[model samples]
Target chain A: MKRVPLSPLRAILARQLRLLRAERGWSQERLAAEAGLNRTYLSAVERSEQNISIDNLYRIAQALDVSAARLLTDL
Target chain B: MKRVPLSPLRAILARQLRLLRAERGWSQERLAAEAGLNRTYLSAVERSEQNISIDNLYRIAQALDVSAARLLTDL
Candidate 1:
């Protein structure tokens, strides 16, 4: 298989997620429950360890009361 | 495995990709090549059959000469 290149975007997204969650004072568990996601999975996403799907991104954004695109902007 | 809910955003993204490629008059093979992805995989994404990861989304957006967030906006 051809290897995928390293992407700075993932780290950027991870930082954005953590920042957003911190701004709301919500723990990973709270955000995960609100987004109907597993807390562990959400933690992985926040750490940029998961190559997150768009559906999950949408769910997380909804739970955070933000646009899906907003999570990815300015990065 | 736990079930993941269906999300309309995937369909929206698929439609956006198709529309963008059409606007450029590029075939799936062409777009796939430009995005450094397999043609069949890219086709699945266009059909909303794949829950595409953000890294691939970034690659596709780069290949299309648009912002990564642009692909998810106005949907």
Candidate 2:
């Protein structure tokens, strides 16, 4: 089988993170701090330049007070 | 805040892959073929030994005839 990429999932997650953070009126730095992630990494995620791990997704979801599943919805 | 991991997302995606494949009565090999991925990687994903990429998830979801968001829900 041919290789398939996984960046779209990252894009979806990034968009969800951005939306969720904005909904809470928090800056990326604040969200990163809250999610216990590096601000630079968070910025890269928001820009779809990075693929986030499951653990980080959970942390961001938790920091946003939503289920991890919510971040993957409607994308 | 402390560093948070991203394995939970991988776990959730793995579970979703297994559930979706079961619902379709397909083996990991079949799903992997349909998703254009390595059967070994598919097995690893089913066993939670690997983290799937967003592109691969979309392929799997398409192969299973579901939205990518569906894979992330209810976990």
Q: Residue A35: error of model 2 in Å? A: 1.3
lDDT for position A44 in model 1: 89
Locate the minimum summed-lDDT window of 10 residues in model 2 chain A: A1-10
RMSD of each: 2.4, 2.6
lDDT per residue (tens digit) for residues A1-75 in model 2: 566655467777777888888888999989989888889998998888876655666787888988877787744
C-alpha local distance difference test of each model: 0.85, 0.77
Model 2 residue B22 CA deviation in Å: 1.7
TM-score of decoy 1: 0.88
TM-score, chain A, per candidate?
0.88, 0.88
Docking class of 2: medium
**Candidate 1 lDDT over residue span B14-64, tens digit each:** 888988999999999999988899999999998889889999998899889
